[model samples]
Target: ADVDYWSGCLAPDKLAARITPATQALVAANANGHPAAWNELRTLASQHGLLLIEDSSEAIGSTYRGRVVGSFGDCAILDFTQPGPLSCSQGALVLTDDIDLASKLRLLRNRRLSDRGSVVAGGLPVADAGIGELNAALGLAQWTRLDDILARRKAVEAHYLKVIQSFEGIKPPYVAPDVDEVHWFLSLVHLGTRFSRGSRDDIVDDLHTAGVEAAAYCLPLHRQARYFDNQRPSQDLWVTDKLADRALALPFHAHLDAEEVEFIVQTAKDASINVGAGSAIYL
Candidate 1:
């Protein structure tokens, strides 16, 4: 909910404009495995004395300006969900250099209440919240093969990019010049402006009908039913809204081989063409 409240990428000037007496922290993501302007954000955060928190969940192996995604902020978080490179089945890891912050996080994760109902903890508690031995073992096994897994995923992404380049009205994901490595969790494509949200959805549905799993991924949080608040003025997230409407997430996984990628790309192209033709007819 906190993230939903302040979600879209704020420009340095826009961020400065939004600051007030109550603004104490700035939480940002290296959104969708592409590096954000973290150095600028860090400078802004420092200028305003606000803590910079990073969510590098989808960017475990990604880097910004030669430094890893999780290394820029005061504290950062990584998700080890099944979709991520380091799949622990279900868990997360927090990164921080501060010992005091680490101790506080330990307490938060494993708070033991005393008989009087006050929390008690000495050092890092051996709490139940910690990863189980079996899950730990599984995560370790996967971690050991991370290099090969990442390479496979990168290969799949490259194939998709190459195939997508030939298709009109669709573009591959953008990686900034500063982003040295991108461990893409999803092979996202952006439809041209001629494509509406309905057009994008139609293509996704067509892909589904053709046995290719694709989706109109990542709707803007402000537009979601739970996050919309009448009391608060709506943010002018024009770019966010546009991206939400056009972005399509194609099937992506390390296990997907060249043949599978070729089929998926072909299906996606066909779906886009069909949808684009239908839109023209309606016009």
Candidate 2:
């Protein structure tokens, strides 16, 4: 089975413009990367009878080309784990317009019609045999608050960009021209050539020592342990690997205050300088 995921900007638009008639499906994930571009890709895919799978795991409140990301594909997936805007203890969901597919997904989760052929507890099942009613209830409640959560997270991301841009060696991650909103799972700053002197690691370690937890946003999916033996040629991911090394994400949450944001920025600036200076050697 061959799959294509959209992560790079130029490539997505290019792929959307041109594809072999043999291509099967086009999959897209990542928050607010570029849905219009993906839409074009989807239309092209449909022209050739290909499936579109949208991953809105990091894009719950994000929009693409004025439509929601989850609304565009044959099937969509959303993560409910920590780091998402509406995170919970566990669970992920798939959404689709097809009733048959929905029924199949329910069956996949182990839900089945009761053999007794009678409704129990006023149309509620006596035995779940799958996801429990309580889990559904919890998710429903969380869904109700998604708007507020996304709003707060967007605000936080905006403030971060505002402050980080003022410091040297920090620039917000790439957001395509067409994206109206960003559901930032992590706020990104490029370490750039400043990393050549080792500033990136110094900044990362400084944040850790200062009680501000931060990390590299992602590793190329092809580099994971399971894929190592069968990894695609390294040249396929020139940009992805570059991002993997030089991008750093700082502590980002709704609860953080302006003072905290300032501190994080200042600390990062110091660390970047230290890395550029090299080895902290005294003259």
Candidate 3:
């Protein structure tokens, strides 16, 4: 699950709490190519004797410490969703050096109910059609085009950064120093305390009215009614909570042209102005 940036009207800090060594299973957010954060998290997991599981669905081409994100943890999982480089329809992959975990996953995801031997062959079998042929074809095609796709996505993100950075009140997501490649899935703009003009909702609506689809990004998971009821929170997250309130995701795709990017930027700036001091805003 994704970490929530906000809870109870407060911004949560990006730093997770230091757990005792008794903790066994560790799950981490995939910060694209941010080596320091990853390094800190890796050390924490190592200290705790925990198996770090990275949700690398958003970091396909990102690197950490000169190694790719998928290689960072004990196990990493990737999703072939719409924004993913490997997307065709839907797919998931798990990567690990641990042979035991790999073998277990294979059996769990693709096991047959029918017995391997003659004595226990009475149960019904579960069959996956696409897992055999369609999945293989999709995988091969995506693998072949992975590099080119990543480059295209990077170009789009660079365009977004160039345009958005020129605007007065929007800050793009941070990219750490050592990240060699980032397979951008979304173009995020943070409206922090510095932005005096408008709220995130206002900006999102303004973009939408101009035919640019935009949205507030992640909500803090801790504040969700279902999750909060069951688990007591351990720390105060000042940064993440603020991010949940102010972060906006603009439309980004490899197919978008420079003209389109310009339009988005112009619209966003206009929206920011409109929302300042209640000038005018549909949202």
Candidate 4:
């Protein structure tokens, strides 16, 4: 399921090839604030008569073809977590126009007191997924100023971009042509081919040694311990694995000022140089 090295979204062709008689729904994410190929995905879903579940948790304000990410799929989900733009401590909101599906989802999440005896259950277990009143209030309050929140994060992104451009081997943010806007979930600096996974780790270690926090962007799902299976034939995801090895995530938040941004970038550059990867960048 891991697809591209760049935007980190699903590949429609790969997804389509994997579809079988048992395939129920198609899930896609506007990963790291970059919109997925919704047009292609929509067509694939329609052709297969499958439901599309859009994951807009990291891309709350990102837009694709002028339409917001959450506005694309049959139903979408928004998370109010710390990493997300809006945080209510913790909870998620699922969006759907289907009343029946909503009702089912609500039932699955939590059985209302009024519905316990009123409705019949087929031995379904309740997850107790109800959001507390305080959390709900907080989420609603933050929702009203969502635009301002996104704008502030965008400003931080600008700072990071401006700083990273001067650092050797790293390019600015990558945005697709069709994407109208991007609201980055994290400040990312992609290491080119000249740096190996170990060198990337060395860079991160150096940053940490300098009291700067940084991290590898992600470990692909298929490579994770839980999902790794030798019996199952490996799907080709060279790009995903390679990108996972190369991508670096730095401290990113609306609170970071220009000076802090410069320090972070400079630290990364110094780290890259220490690892013998600063000059010979694989552009």
| Best-fitting candidate, scored by lDDT | 4
Pairs of residues clashing in candidate 1: none
Model 2 superposed RMSD (Cα):
6.3
**Candidate 4 colliding pairs:** none
Clashes of each: 0, 0, 16, 0
Displacement of the residue 164 alpha carbon in candidate 3, Å: 1.3
**Total clashing pairs in model 3:** 16
| Native-structure RMSD, model 4 | 2.1
Rank by lDDT, descending? 4, 1, 2, 3
How many clashing pairs in candidate 4? 0
Tens-digit lDDT track for model 3 on 50-126? 88887787777877667887787799888776766777576678889999887667665654456455444323343
Our model 3 lands, by Cα RMSD against the true structure, at: 5.4
Where is model 1 poorest over a 10-residue stretch in terms of lDDT?
1-10
Candidate 2 deviant stretches above 4 angstroms = 1-10, 13-23, 32-36, 113-135, 196-199, 277-283
Give the per-residue lDDT digits (tens) of candidate 1, residues 1-283. 1221122344566567777999989878866676667888899999999988888988878888889888988899988885777888877778999898887887666554542376554655544576667888898898899888888888888888777776675644565666688788788877776789998999999999988889888877677776665444445666677777788988998888778888998888888887775332211
TM-scores of the models, in the order given: 0.86, 0.81, 0.81, 0.92
Q: Per-prediction RMSD in angstroms?
A: 4.6, 6.3, 5.4, 2.1
Off by over 4 Å in 3: 1-16, 32-36, 113-136, 194-198, 277-283
Q: List model 2 lDDT by residue over 1-283, tens digit each.
A: 1122223433555455545777777776654333435656677667778887787777777776687778877889887777777666567788999998777676566534574475334333333334456666777797998888777877787778778876664434565666776677776666655464245666788888887787766666777877788865566566666666677778877777778888887887776776664332211
TM-score of 3: 0.81
Predict model 4's lDDT versus the native: 0.84
